[model samples]
Target: MSDWPPHPEAAAVPSLSDLLERYATLRDTILSLENEKNELGELIKAALLRGERAETELYRSSVRVQKRLEYPLERFREVFGDAAALEAASIDRKKAEALARAGDLDPERLREIALVKEIQALVLTPKGS
Candidate 1:
């Protein structure tokens, strides 16, 4: 209503220091919330185990209970046989890295075998406190 376009100088620009501070504050808040969420999740699991019903009102909430069977590596191999164990075993990256560094394996081949993804991250260091 007032002006169709605002002046460049009139526009507010956030400084790097301000942005870094905000990022750090947000990271800390997210970590705190995650911890709270994990604690609440455990409580909910307990409630579900105790036969608490899922509610659907202003906020729809449900608890899913699942039973999982975990087998010991050595015992599992003994019970299911070595062929079954070999089939279930995942590729070990550390061993592969060692092999590559020792010149026993090609680095390019190793990279090809593993899922490679490039990520850019912002690193902030605080001034002397």
Candidate 2:
């Protein structure tokens, strides 16, 4: 084959004006894509910020509900006087003893114990950490 570049017509075909026009068109296309990329980046940033705010709000709401329940739980203990509390304890002891008497363990008592263990796990967790 002959030399690939610098054919005589190659230098003569595109005038300076035509080359400048092509450069301008490519520059405008690049700038438009840049603007679109910037807009998309800004949108992504705003969405991430909003998601963080929503997570914070959800945590705050959960704390509020937990705080609201505290008073009622205390009131329930107060309303059920000491005598009733002792009676309930006695009944529980009797039930436990009865379960021991039986050959098989009480599944209900086991379930209650498991539930209490789970609840205590939640209760002892440090706040805001």
Candidate 3:
């Protein structure tokens, strides 16, 4: 007898049922962990708001809150003229895409302006449910 156990060919290939079961298990695990994380985040936020800090063997955590100033576009435009508001604002993607489609602008120019990424996902559903 060899030191290593013999591998069965059947064990090498996973069935669709096995894959689906594993997928479901992982999905449930991810959802449960996400819920726990959200709950912890809310607790952290509450503690921080109450001027509390937490120090553990593994980590030290504190919150620093800051104020941000926001300008309402239409109201701002009404107050400061459209040209000035447009100069202050960032590029509008929809208008840029339209211009690119119309050949009024070079698509190559967008390489520096935007970073495009592709995403793929597998969606599983129960039969007739």
Candidate 4:
């Protein structure tokens, strides 16, 4: 018989203390990875929020400009006495109402709104407008 105590597997397995130490190391590693994941998630969320806010501000500015354009357009019609102007306004009102109903107005995107108006003005080219 050997001097050491007999073991079923010839004592090849690691000691209890060694196993405990390995387990602690693995646990700490998992925790660190989790923390890193959380930090990255927070960073992504904040960046998205900032982008949304900027887009919203631009849209709001555009809405204000669009309102100003409407006033001038109305005044021009009042002075010029053009029938086509009234018809164009009817179309514009319908479009605005449709956009509103479709949730596509996005009153916060001013540059895009202005571009749309400019394009419409060019395309429609109301007689002598």
Candidate 5:
């Protein structure tokens, strides 16, 4: 990110203190810019609702309504009966994993259905010679 004109300290290897200061500056700048962007986005959404259609030389904005259905389980089951409520049921991953690990279920099938995900960040890499 410091690559455009190249930061002054980049001329030589930056000390850890210099890197920490630069990191804080960039982080704060990003947060400020994001806040500004979110405020503008809310304005554009409101304009779209008023049928004013916010547009710029480079971009045009349109609004779409996204919806989700949530039901209170006991009340819903009383109204719709058990079969309809069956559609809303989900497997408990931890219990399923326990069974699979014990060889009572196919681990591969569990993996497919569970769709577990991991979050990772790039911390370091070996330099190429």
Candidate 6:
């Protein structure tokens, strides 16, 4: 990154190729750091798993134990009955869109009621793949 910002006073702006190369390098570094961080996190959790605590000059860390229960829905229904939970949505959105486009479902109604979202993405693929 010695040439980072690419000398703003220079006559030439950075090419897209140069910008992409820098972006890829930074992304790889971030991924490597993330992997190392995750490994250290596992070690910390293992140490704290025995109801232990650890501290450094700047920080103290401890793990809190929690219990969660899991059971079959039928078991729950038998114990509590059906009224506790209600069916929410059954619509398959893609099918609904296809029907709307084919003039089965109302297109105007879909447009009026559908949630709209728009996003921009920059994607980089491996050169040979």
Per-residue lDDT of model 3, residues 41-122, tens digit only: 6787677658876655555565545432334556545654666457546435555455557775555654344534332221
Candidate 4 lDDT trough over 10 residues, lowest sum: 118-127
Off by over 4 Å in 3: 1-12, 65-129
For candidate 5, lDDT tens digit of each residue in 15-122? Answer: 788778888988999999999987876776666667785444555556655432234446544654565446445334554455557875566744543333442221
- Candidate 1, residues 21-49, lDDT tens digits: the string is 77798799999999998787677656655
Q: Model 1 residue 129 lDDT?
A: 18
What lDDT does the true structure give each of the candidates?
0.55, 0.44, 0.56, 0.45, 0.56, 0.56
> Model 2: per-residue lDDT, tens digit, 1-129?
734234777756767787788779879999999999768545644554455322342232111112211112232225444553343343354443344357334445433432121111111123365
Model 3 scores a C-alpha lDDT of 0.56
lDDT string for model 4 (1-129, tens) is 533333677757668887788779879989999999768545644554455322332232111112223323454345433553454464364554454456644334312333233211101122333
Give candidate 2's error at residue 54 in angstroms: 16
Q: What TM-score would every model get versus the actual structure?
A: 0.41, 0.31, 0.43, 0.31, 0.45, 0.45
lDDT, model 1: 0.55
lDDT (tens digit, per residue) of candidate 6 on 25-108: 989999999999878877777777666677665566655454322323453334334542122112334544565577655556
Tell me how far the alpha carbon of residue 18 in candidate 4 is from the true structure, in angstroms, after superposition.
Answer: 1.3
Name model 4 segments beyond 4 Å from true.
Answer: 1-11, 52-129
Q: What's the residue-level lDDT of 125 in candidate 1?
A: 28
